[model samples]
Target: MLARHHDPIAAIATAPGRGAVGIVRVSGHGLAPFVQALLGRALRPREAHYLPFPDAQGQPIDRGLALFFPAPHSYTGEDVLELQAHGGPVVLQLLLARCLEAAQGTAGAAGTAASVLPHLRLAAPGEFTERAFLNGKIDLAQAEAIADLIDASTAAAARSAGRSLSGAFSEEIHGLRDALVHLRMLVEATLDFPEEEIDFLRKADARGQLSKLQHMLATVMQRAQQGALLREGIKAVIAGQPNAGKSSLLNALAGAELAIVTPIAGTTRDKVQQTIQIEGVPLHVIDTAGLRDSSDEVEKIGIARAWEEIAAADAVLFLHDLTRQNQPDYVAADAAIAHTLAERLPPGVPVIDVWNKTDAAPGVQPGSAPGHEAVRLSARTGEGLDTLRHLLLEAAGWQPAAEGLYIARARHTEALRAVDAHLMEAAAQLESSGPALDLLAEELRLAQNALGAITGEFGADDLLGVIFSSFCIGK
Candidate 1:
């Protein structure tokens, strides 16, 4: 995978289907010969020339506009060729095959002797953007933003991804890196001038510099947190005993009849999920089967799946029917479900007790679930649902949509957190009386490395493979 980038690559650059126009793109070193051989002439750089893209017999496959970009001035930092043709799968496929055939010296007619390009092949998914990163045209964060922009689910998400692609996120990472590098220089210099170390440290205000960096990192982390929330929304699972109005709550929240609403206890035997956006943040809500001991084999499987979803959930809504709050048996079953939730849920997962059917029992005062706040609502009438929405957003730790927010991945936030940890350790070493300068220097060094990983300065090959492989082809 690491060595694949050295080869010239070709692929259809447009979306699959019938459209007004489609494009076949090629990129690599010395693509001039390939272009001259396929198009029957050497075209000027960066100019669109109307030409006939020919097959082996000098047969015109299609007449289209061809644009050429030379090395160091293209999207992938290599020579690039784009053929704009009529939008049809067959035309694009034939054009791509002809390009490959000419490059690989497999064309039967063999009209041009100088047209063969050595090591030309098809591009892998994201290989174009990966080359851009590898050749210093963009950093890892910006490369990732290309994918985020293509996959953005909402307008706000698309805008945020655009910001990231333009280097807003990488700029912050680079800022941290620069600051960290400065501190490391100061710490390392102390060893070179040991006799003046005490006076130098006092004059330079190392402690003050460290404090400022920590503050800057704190602010950056908060922004990244918001960005990550926008990029990867929270997963919420709605669960409870039989007939607690779980499906009704789903319908009310989604403002649609997504899940079937019936008095029957086990109407939903599998998980039903819908993604709803609140203030540009996506919330994936899931409705699970009614929790109960049953003789039916299917219900048992559903109950088991519910537990699995709960275990992996970011938040859970434990639904309780307001009318049944007074029944001893109903209350006991709710308690048993609560006990299982506590035992099975991972630590830090929020559970919001939702009391449903408020219209059915208007006089019943809903008690909050123990150890957590409760939201009382009638899913059928849409009462108190707005309150529930706000609480779920709070559980997700999302703030009001802010200005200049950039989309970030889970890895970006995790890397920032790791940098923060190292900075904290360095701060401790700086504060200790008769501090060990070596320890302080090591911490700062590690902190910079962690920060560098965000922009590919310190990333591993496998990490690159995992990141770029997720991108759409021809990007």
Candidate 2:
């Protein structure tokens, strides 16, 4: 009966391509009859039966184990079936066809056709998780956590994602919601009584409650920002004048020649990006075109794009040649470039100066710190790379802790920020002599709604569709 939401979805729950075992999962109403059509019997719920998957005309296409999960306890909270078959692409296709045929033919207890069944629909990216959210099996934040866990590149990232999936993030939001609800009750109570007897407006306790709520919201928002950083990582761009060893540095840091390096000024025109994990922090290293004035149309376009990259970069590496230091023009050029780029870069973006090719210049060792904040390094010799890495991590505000982190996305962080904003507004209203009760209540409601979005409590059907559509078909 639950299948009325749409078509039943199917997809290979296992990863694509060859494996020791492949699973094709089907979930929705009328799934039992479909399984019976192939297995040829009424199998007990939650029981695994080794049966031959029959094709049309009751012919066996492949033999495998079939497990039936009755509705209400299944992953999708619907009648679900799993057919485990040999990991052959063709073989799995045949089994899927058999399941589809069975699903199409089954009728519900009602005389009408079981149109509630999803008609063998394709599952979107994260549809199963979406269904689980709709069924109250998990909240919205947990559903997003599933995606983060799948895409985690480091152990810390995965661990954080797992914690989120386990409801660490949602629990905090729920706690905040409970506090807000209680505060709203006390504030609204003042409206029900006569002004003279209503001591609510003058109560010190009410003001204290508002203060506490604001502090709590601020704390949670700060942590959510840090969690987002760990999940999204940073985009660090290497930008400088031509032949400043940008390509060499990219190769050295990546431990591979991802970019072509030569004495040629425009050897690197396009951007090359490598996602690297340094001690579990995901870093997106972008090697951009060397910023310079060019006459060639293509090179000019590339240089302009390089500046764009620099503008958006979380951090910029303004590399320079150390040997050219004595030349007055060289010093003026570097200073001018730095000042110009600073105007274009986003506010708060940290630009680190890197003096490369220092091996050729005496008194420049990997451990030696330059008079400026810049680091002296030889990308070719792999010296001072560690210092650069540490600096990048420090810029990200990443500090290794024994535990207590969870994976979070920018969306989740935004929601938390929204909640914090509303809470602050509510606090401000409560403090006013003529209590802005209406505005305070409205802000409290907004805060609750923001928190609800994290767990699917405030999401729309279309939002659910978009979220779940990303999952594999049979998931």
Candidate 3:
């Protein structure tokens, strides 16, 4: 809990640089004295007063509107003050310096100094929200949502953050936690006096509660995954033999010559990546060197790097040249890649055969392969690009109504997955060996803790620091 100190914390609560107005914010019990010193007069809470802000020597710094918000109802659950002034960087800096000077000194009578005063310090990144959390103004989940709102990249991301800030995510977690507690209470009551013969653990109602808990957690995990995908886009890698039109496909998809197209083989001995948005979904398109056997040290090194890239990619596009007849070298190249990636690629990674250069070849239909469903198109002419786009979207499970998606990090997705795993384990324990109630209870508790980490109900110290410090100042 935050200490109810008389001291105040101050910061420029608006973004830096030029704007219509810049806001210098202060919050705590000592706001009254701080305001009087800076404004050259006392101010009534919840009222906006126009006044000339003064420097340390009583010289006028700037004329601005001052606002006061009394304690227990303000953002930090403390008395808050806001000075709205010209937004120029230089002017704001001078204004901020004067405010700090005013906060540090004795209490003032009109424009003169008095004996007693309150101490104030600058707010750190996310510190104001942290204080809000400490003071019960907002919960851990809502506090994190505030930071997410500031960093949202898309409209859907912003909306999801807003929902979480409004306690949508927290409400779900709390509901689950409440159910767990009820079940734990029932189990503990039975285990406390086994001789009662009531058999409380064998009741149908207990099983129903366990089942419902599992189902609710599963639904939340799925939604969290979607939100994470919307927040952090997938990494798609393009890999194939040399001269398979990989570079051309990259250029076509990216709408620019991001990579150099050439007829010569082994031209690209490095990986090139371009970020493109398809129907609002960001795709990190990585073009890797053509996978092949090479004696040249540089080419071999690039080929090695290409394998690493393919292994890390969310999906891989295996490009093939349809115009050229199947040759032994091409067959061997494809075979080598297939054997190398037998265990490396994640399950369900879309490995589509991309048939490029269809315009140069005659009588070949520009479509998928025979019984293989390959995407046939001319990368140079932009044919079948739309088909490829649709395939990518389908592979990602993207839908038209994806506005419900929330932005989540990989750590968040992993945590949710771990929660799901534990919940399932707990469900299994509920029915085994006369109901291992203690282990089952522990598993449910662990599951709740994992979910809690996503919304900051429970988090490692380093993680809390990392999450908040990443925020922009004045946020």
Predicted model with the maximum lDDT: 1
Model 2 ranges with Cα > 4 A deviation: 1-6, 106-118, 194-198, 201-204, 362-373
Show the colliding residue pairs in model 1. none
Per-residue accuracy of model 3 over 318-350 as CA lDDT, tens digit each: 788776645777766676766566567877776
Work out how many backbone clashes candidate 1 has: 0
Candidate closer to the true structure by lDDT (higher is better), 2 or 3: 2
Q: What lDDT is reached at residue 292 by model 2?
A: 67
Rank all candidate structures by their lDDT, best first, as comma-separated numbers: 1, 2, 3
Which stretches of model 3 miss by more than 4 angstroms?
Answer: 1-7, 47-50, 106-119, 196-198, 266-269, 293-304, 362-373
Clash statistics: count for each candidate: 0, 20, 2
The TM-score that candidate 3 achieves is 0.87
Give the local distance difference test score of model 3. 0.75
Q: List all candidate RMSDs to the true structure.
A: 1.8, 3.8, 3.5
Q: For residues 59-78, what per-residue lDDT tens digits would candidate 2 score against the true structure?
A: 67778888888878888787
Residue 5: error of model 3 in Å? 10
Q: Least lDDT summed over 10 consecutive residues: which range in candidate 2?
A: 107-116
Best by TM-score: 1
For all candidates in order, the CA lDDT equals 0.89, 0.76, 0.75
Cα-lDDT of candidate 1: 0.89
